[model samples]
Target: MAADGTFSPVPTGEKSPEGAIGPRSNTGQKGGAGALIDYCTVVLPESSIEDHGVTWLPNLIGQLFGTNGAIVVGSIRNKPWQFYSQSAVLLDREGEMVGRVGLGGNGSTICVSLSGAGCRWVTRWDNVAKAVERWRGKLSRVDVAYDDYDGECLDVHALRERAAQGDFASGGRPPMHRFLSDEGHGTGCTLYVGAKGHKELCVYEKGKQLGLKTSPWVRAEVRMYGKHTALPLDVLTRPLDYLRGAYSVLQEIITGFCTRIRTTRKAVEATGTAMVEWMHRQVGPAINLLREAFGASWADFAEVHIAREGHPGRFRGVAKGDRLAQLMREELCPS
Candidate 1:
């Protein structure tokens, strides 16, 4: 257990496998795009989900990491609102739960915990669009809950009013707005209904304020919750289907949230590279499967890179740092 009393399932002193992807450090300065390739190689092969029979959440959680990759936490009740821990609650070396994953009730909720470093590499709008494509047809609603502690003074009431006006809805479509609490004031809490019937988007503030004098950085809790009646509890038990669906939804939420938040150019590029590299590393069979399933392609990946670099403005050219340039070169010209 950690000092905070939460349990981390990761074992102590266990190093990441020889070629694992993602940052080994908290800051994500070391790995670059190579980490993404390693990560995809690691998770892509185990992407298959099978019926493992009914099991408890705790028992199912233990199988999600290491060689097995992500799997569904099965429930016997076959309830419409199935709960999952998301990919964020990975175990540490001591098997302690490092980082946090939200647990709540909704029609169907998929949670993903992004490390400080992982957040830089994994979240983007294009990536989200691709991830959610498979489940898009079945989705009835989508909600996002993001934690904001960047010291931006946000007026909750104004946001709610805007939501009421459909300002948040895309394409001039109006969304049903509701406040989570009776307090009319906003602490950066608001929900927007998806233009698609039954779809919803939620953005909420997380973490706690220390005192008037010591305000901690705010953590955002952005969730993508929706209603998909087509996915009954029994079908969710199938690991591959569950993972595919969860991965899509989780990526969508993360991408949407990151796009809204402020980030550095370097960080965005690194993340875009990681996202693309991971897609490229998918197994031939899996690639074909994904293509057949969602019409995904390498062509779409260009958007991720472009979004990260930003659209051309008055500035004609942006210089790249030595490290970043090297990473980009390597990705462009794989050794």
Candidate 2:
């Protein structure tokens, strides 16, 4: 979409002061604070009714990011993506779309991905992690990056040489790397390790990419994918560690962190919350298959009203804490 122009910042004064906008942490061994998470895609399972609706994301963002900015949506295109539809843009305090939300996908899942701006806009990383835990969300992709303005500590050519020296070697099998350049087009060069399956590392010239040809700014990024593999939430807390662990070359460069081993997440018990996640994970595929083969009418399952917990904003039309009683008595219920 033609997303770039001027996005109006959500108005705030007494109710929410400018102080509500948190400060950003700088993380560079030299020049600037650039150690950061640049991209992330969080996947969440949806109950049959919760999966498809215009109001779902509009209702959820305030609670999810704790932002008072009103939600506005756009499109992920008219076509379905990863089987999801009705995608919305995530609102920052500036009212700009820093991320996207998708609903009505396979297994009735909702997928959310935040761009570099979104990751930086959300200051409370702990709250995000806590929300994911509370909602049983699985992070499908998380990218951690560190900038080297002087290119003193990290260099693409240096990394390439390290790869040749077997410094990037993992499990006695060195990561595959490929070098790509615009060839004097002033677009800068990139060195990719492991290149795009499960986990990868990327090194590039940041300044050149931003149109500053004389800049010494370089960036090294590590990307971890949880699609086919398990991703621990620790990456949210200790991103630097995970970044360094992506390669031995990185471990040697990014100092003060020594943990190179991958962490394992514990299996969740089939509790109510886990069951919600499990239903989408374990049972959702079957439901989706039936929906595809027959149709929504032909493929349906019964939902038992086991309990009533009043949590508003998590679902559409659920305001404050009063709607649980009404929802249980709604016509959608199989009374």
The per-model lDDT (C-alpha) reads 0.31, 0.56
- Best prediction by lDDT: 2
TM-score of each: 0.29, 0.61
Q: How many backbone clashes does candidate 1 have?
A: 35
| Residue pairs clashing, model 2 | 26-33, 27-33, 27-34
Q: Give the TM-score of candidate 1.
A: 0.29
Best by TM-score: 2
Kindly list the per-residue Cα lDDT of model 1 for residues 1-335, writing each as its tens digit: 12332212122232223322112221222222111111110111111211333133444333332113222232223232224333334433323333333334432343333233322233222232233332232222222222233535334455566666655543444545567652533222434334333333444432111111122223322222233332222111111112112222222222112222232333333344444544567555665664576575543653553237432221112122464455455544567
How many residue pairs clash in each candidate at the backbone level? 35, 3
Q: Write the per-residue lDDT of candidate 2 for residues 145-200, one digit (tens) a residue.
A: 76665666777787788877777766567778888886888668998888574678
